[model samples]
Target: MNWIEIAGHTGALLSSITFIPQVYKVWKTKSVGDLSLYMMLIVFTSTLVWLAYGVALNLWPVILANGFICFLSILLLYFKFAFSRKVIVVAKVKESE
Candidate 1:
């Protein structure tokens, strides 16, 4: 592949993994306190738009990268809600005790 394509792929790989560590950390700790829902929603929306743009332009790098990023972002967002609710439930139980 040409250097340009190589760079694109490299960037795609980097972009795709950005959320991985955060996902793992949150999953392991069951903590979403530091994650911002607004930022996540904005990023998730932007990823969707970028994915659509990439598909329309037939750009493989953008398509593949944004698709994976979309998945990661959604997973993180899910964890945010799930873990936050879990914390609230546990707090309620403790309060009642």
Candidate 2:
């Protein structure tokens, strides 16, 4: 692949892995109260658009990257809501400090 194409894939890989630490932290701590639902929603929506564009253009890298990123977003979103009210309140309280 050309340098430009390689760069694109590199960017895609980096972006796709961006959420790994966040996901791991949240999952381990079970604390997502500080995370904004709206932001996650926006990311999810944007990824969907990116995925669609990639599909339309027949870009595998884009498709794979956005697809994985979208899944992470959705997983985080679910964690935010799936967390119990008590846990959320405690998490928020801790975040305030």
Candidate 3:
């Protein structure tokens, strides 16, 4: 493959794995309180568009990257509603000078 094609594939791989950490963290903590619902919705929508564009252009990289991202976004969205929001309150004690 050419350099440009290789770069595209590399980028695709990176993009596909980008959300794994966040997903894992949320799954482990069971916290979606800090995550924005709107952001996930926008990402899911945008990935859908990218997937359509990629399909139209027959670009495997775009298709794979956006497809994986789309799935991740959906998972996040589900987590947002399915998981309870956990708020941790920290109380600061005054120290004597």
- Which candidate leads in TM-score? 1
The residue pairs found clashing in candidate 2 are none
Model 3 per-residue lDDT tens digits across residues 61-97: 7888899999999889888887852232212222322
Worst 10 residues of 3 by lDDT: 85-94
lDDT for residue 41 in candidate 1, whole number 0-100: 93
lDDT of each: 0.91, 0.89, 0.85
Q: Per-residue lDDT tens digits of candidate 1, residues 11-91? A: 879988999999999999998998899988987999999989999999987888888889989999999999999988989
CA RMSD (A), model 3: 7.1
lDDT of 2 by residue, 16-73 (tens): 9998899899899988878888998998999999999999999998898989999999
Question: What CA root-mean-square deviation does each model show from the true structure?
Answer: 1.5, 5.4, 7.1
- Clash counts per candidate, in order, are 0, 0, 0
The better candidate by TM-score, 2 or 3, is: 2
Pitting candidate 1 against candidate 3, the one with the higher lDDT is: 1
